[model samples]
Target: MALAADFRHRYVTPEASLYAGEPTRCEELAELLRHILQMVDRNTPFRHGAYREIYEALHGFLHAGIGGSAKDGLVWGVKDFWAVWESICLVHVVNQNPGDILTCDMEHLPVLLSAPERRRAWLKQRALLFARNGIRRRPDLVLAGGDDIKVVDFKYYAYMRQQRRTAEADEIDKIEKDYLSMEAYGLLLQNHFLRNADARANRLSLEFWLPGAKAARQPSRQQPPWDPPLSVVHLPAEDLLRGYVALYPHLRLMR
Candidate 1:
């Protein structure tokens, strides 16, 4: 079966042109995405019907007009795509190290609150606590080996190039706010794992994956004061594996 079927309507053509000069690299990316889909289909608990739902949604998103009535599907599809893509990348990276154990879609990590009442309240709030505006904040992938644990969060923007060149003030503001939200999510993960006795002494790292324009990382004055001190790492889609290895040297892939 094909890894990713071509959409009947192309929402973004420049995505092809973006790789105009690098056929090999483009092919590699396509294969990786396909492998990811196949692995998820074969190994994950999601059934064939679930895979169809994803494909149908992606198809609809691609065919819909920009800013059209199908905006919700487009948004959902983009988010789902990145979530799967990040999982695949992390799995590939960790598998390179035969000794490391990689876990995808990990859940039930304790929320950072200490008091039982506060934890209960946060749990009751649920979606409100985990979401900023309409965007949900959650860790996408985790890797553990020996005494170290790494939690990764991925944020994918398909039109980041266009956003960089032409996004208005309000749009820019929204992006900054999203970064702050991501920072909060990272801190939450770090604190949550640290509070666990088993993981307390383990090395923990939280990272944000933003595969966009170089300028996307420029410090913004509107950033939240409480944002974590860690900086967002700009990782081009093509170099995801390399960038990840650099950030977590302990999880290096064996050549």
Candidate 2:
């Protein structure tokens, strides 16, 4: 059978008319997707999340039936930007190390496992699970081996706010909370292993990573005896996307 002229005109050749309101790219892409849908209808299979996501966006915007576009009530700018930030950081870490990073109790966070060859392993031996939203339920990531473990929390703190000379009234509170939270994370991680008799390390190695410029000298670190030695690296945004490369050697990658 042949494709309809009206269908082709509206989606494939939609321009220099009232239909020009819709982007040419969306029109072209949606037309191509028509062919893909035809294949799917014939029992051909193509399992991909990207295709589905784009299809839904196009369908709603294009009204899913004939050729008319709707842009009202369609918005960007997510309120859960923190969730997106968390996922991106996880992607960077997994992509950087490939097969080195270990995740525990991440059934709730599939973004980390979205890639087929992410090279990350699900930690089953003494894995830790918590009660809360997906982001809060577990540490962002952990690197562990024979007797060394590093629990990394991708705390998207507003570092620039605190780095300024004139701190905001809440800056001190944020700093103190961030510091103490890392301490608590250390203890939680330490006990998490000890309880299951699966102590991967003699003690927990706590580290929280922040997004910022690489420091000329060490930014800061605490080494109190009672608490696990807490260290942090302010990874540059540029380096984070590059998967921790161009980052400081201290950004330990355990494989």
* TM-score list, all predictions: 0.36, 0.46
Give per-residue CA lDDT, model 1, range 22-66, as digits (tens). 756555544554555566556867557867878645444433223
Model 2, CA-based lDDT: 0.50
Best by TM-score: 2
- In candidate 1, position 213 carries an lDDT of 41
| lDDT of every model, 2 decimals | 0.45, 0.50
Give the Å shift of residue 33 in candidate 2.
Answer: 28
TM-score of model 2 (CA atoms): 0.46
Instruction: Show the colliding residue pairs in model 1.
Output: none
Listed per model in order, the count of residue pairs whose N, CA or C atoms clash below 3 Å is 0, 0
For model 2, give the 10-residue run with minimal summed lDDT.
70-79
Question: Which residue pairs overlap in candidate 2's backbone?
Answer: none
Error of 1 at 120 (Å): 24
Task: Give the per-residue lDDT digits (tens) of candidate 2, residues 63-143.
Answer: 343222422211222223344345556656545664556663243233323444432435443234333234354566777
